[model samples]
Target: MPILPRVALLLAACLAPATLAAAPDRAPQDVSGRVLRATGTTTSGEGIPGIAVSNGIDIVRTDAQGRYRLAAGAGQTVFVVKPPGYRFAEAADGLPAFWRTVPADRTAGAMAIDFTLVAEDRPAVSAPEVLLFTDSQVKSARDIDYYRRDIVEPIIGRHPAALGVTLGDLVDDQVQLYAALNAVTVRLGVPWFHVPGNHDVDPGSTGDAASLATWGATYGPDTYAVEEGDAAFVFLDDVVVRPGGTGYVGGLREDQFRFLGNYLAQLPRERLLVLGMHIPVFDTGGRETFRGADRARLFALLKDRPKVLLLSGHSHVQQHYWHAAKDGWQGAAPLHEYNVGAACGAFWSGAPDAQGIPDATMADGTPNGYAVLSLRSGGGYALAYHPARLAAGTQAFTPAMALHAPRVLRRGAYPAWGVFANVFMGDAGTRVEYRVDGGDWLPMRRVERADPRLLVENVADDVATALRGFDRSPEAVPPTHLWRGALPTDLAVGEHRVEVRAFDRWQGEAVAATTYSLQEAGP
Candidate 1:
């Protein structure tokens, strides 16, 4: 539990804020905004009441006249919650614009921030699909070109999703590339939301407040919310910039908690709560990747909520984690968090395809790709991963999982060897089974071992004398999503089809296949 702040600080926070470290002693100014409904025919004015507005710490709903007033300190942002059934205008770079950053120089007068949304043709749908891209991590113009060709061109004009969001690391420490990235996204023609990753921070920043100046200028707000379909999506800037070139850590700021407290209080209990950020809340390897106290506080806030999903992306690999009693999550069921795979898997390293795009396979053998998050009618959701391109220039259908097995085995020999299946989106309890020659399915053991597929590439790179590509593929790491099944060599000498099937909780059954041959052993 957090203690109450001083009366003066309370007034400064306006929305009743709680902080682990108190903000500087500075008076806040009143910030007012009006939510207006605009159309192609009418321009005069139409107030839209009940629209949520915020000053980064406090949330306020528009009054009957669509007006709201909240307090904000210097360097804060004033933003409007984009609700369903409406559309916002595009920024100069073609990104959906929704927030205004308060000038750091302003100290005295009231600030006015207004937002206008155009009415849509249809009401909010029961289910909405979102395209999820993480850690694009583009560092230069060429990388951006690879991003467009490899990640964007395939989905262009297809409209595979109603909306899109980049979970973070939009660039690799090159803040200027944000514009170039959005320029490419403009072609997708969907309202895209962005979460700032640690790499998105400006290198010259003096502190956390100053770090995202470049990001805020282009992407709007460091933290904000959007209401779509049956879910409320809350985006947070959880990457805390350490002072004096100490790098960064995953943690929440006091003002974010304040905004969350105020906003969650007003949200309906029946709607799904989708929390998005750049860093995973779970501590990595007991090394405290995220502040444990902040995670506990966030879990406490969601303890009473029935439907919640945490989405984050930072590590190049993909994974799913759950919070239990040990992690201080008190919800009725364990909390589920999806640490999504990076779009620029392993920093876009690996051998290039015919298109000059790097294979970009993750060290764990997951392809460099994006995910589709299908928000269900009720509180349920479904998810699927789409690889940007096939591995090693293969033209086969996008595989659910990659298979690695020996092409031949000695008959009448011990079945010591096995097949390894790297389920790109698999988790701990995923049901994985394999069958031979369409025979009965047998459970495949989940094993934490390097995906042999990448190990082959690793071996290829190790012996190469020259540069393999833009960069060599990441060294293979034992991934949690791998499964293994022993190969039986006692079978008759012939080619046998081996099919592995796994049930993904999000997308249901997935089946992939390969083959092996057996030959009689010589005396």
Candidate 2:
């Protein structure tokens, strides 16, 4: 076990309230405020006991009558911590129906919010395919049209995935568009869950309590859980509102950590614990994007659960991270975090195509698209990336890398013209290799730099005389998935095939091929 930081140990001790003590029966608190009687029942109206409910602060359990009362202030959201074997009803656009926001009109007094859960008879899904989309950020009808044409159209009624999940940033600062997003997602014909991103916050809220008011009204609780087959998926609201609604920060509240501890305590260790959120728990750019103490508390809870996967999406970049003991992970195996790419690649910016959709390749050269995760019977998971558009004259599934090199090169000038491969999901440890004319494979060095192709793509709009469709793709940022190597300078004046292959830590390999010709020195 790793040594606990002094602050984490102190926070843990302070967070151990009497409410968490084991008791056969406890009476409701005698606090003065808006009292909410939260009751849980089956679809047939039978009371279901021992369900936990929260108002984002205090956690209370139902009595033998399947009811629990908690205090709720104005703009507070009261949500149920959904139990196993029961499924909450979903909203029209696939948001879980597990929470309710107290109206501001009711300044004082008591109200009753009852939750009805239907018994779910899920099949023994030994291997289930799950759809994952991130950073859709739909803001207008045109954006919706783009999504419908490119994403929804190709995915509906075709995929065999059991369910789908969006890793936050559902809309671009317009909570109202969630309905439109939901309408589009509903056609997928599967249960969908969401996480609250920074952009999803209500700007009018002065504090964190009301930041998710609109989100809760539309997508149920910001924090909840769902169990499918042998996997338990937990969604946490990691975006805390900045004071005065100026911005947001990546941190977990004490109550959220409390909820994780209380909920996970009831679950068996054998279940695969899949944690999903908007901001990543891992560090980014030497910054403490996530609170270290909060992360330590969570790691302490899941230290024994060997099968775990962390998912997040707020940076609009796809990359993988492994957390070992130094990062506070105590498991025998390192934990994996998959920071998925955006569906609205580069915020729907770039050159337009024949269909009027933007190229929108990400800074890392990952095309605007989604991912598919396959879960096996023995708590194993594999992920595959899918691109939105295929290259010219090709119909097969898109490859991960898009090689950036000129189609023709002058002899002896190959040293200046290096081949750069943009491996969409690669990290520093990923193995990248390239070969010329199907010869010996040579290693390509990983480079933490902006994607050269994106730089060139952005230059197209910068140098154009008139504005084009949509907007120009933003300037390229330093990418974590790029590799480069100089080509051989002695090739003959003929066509040469360059083949590149990349292998991720999960044992997934992707390959791409292109041909270029070497020309004579003089004309």
Q: Each model's TM-score, in the order given? A: 0.91, 0.83
Q: Backbone clashes in each candidate structure, one number apiece?
A: 0, 0
Q: Which lDDT values do the candidates have, in the order given?
A: 0.82, 0.74
How far out, in Å, is residue 107 in model 2?
10
Candidate 2 — which residues are off by over 4 angstroms? 1-88, 92-94, 100-122, 325-331, 394-397, 505-507
Worst 10 residues of 2 by lDDT: 29-38
Find the candidate with the highest lDDT and give its number: 1
Q: What residue pairs are clashing in model 2?
A: none
Q: lDDT (0-100) at residue 257 of candidate 1?
A: 94
- Per-residue alpha-carbon lDDT of candidate 1 for residues 1-523, written as tens digits (9 for 90 to 100): 1111132123334432222022223224677767788664353387766667777776766655666677776777788887766667666777776887788898786677788876665545667788899999999999999899988988888864667899999999998788788889889988899999999999877678789878877887888898776778999999999888688889999989998998887777887899999999988866989988899899989999999999999988888888889989999999999888898999999998887889899989899999888888777888788878765543112457888999999987899999998888898889999999988999999998899989999999999999989799999998889999999887889998888898988778988888899998677
Error of 2 at 161 (Å): 2.4
* Residue lDDT tens for model 2, 384-457: 88888877873112457788767788887737777888888788888999999989999998887788778887
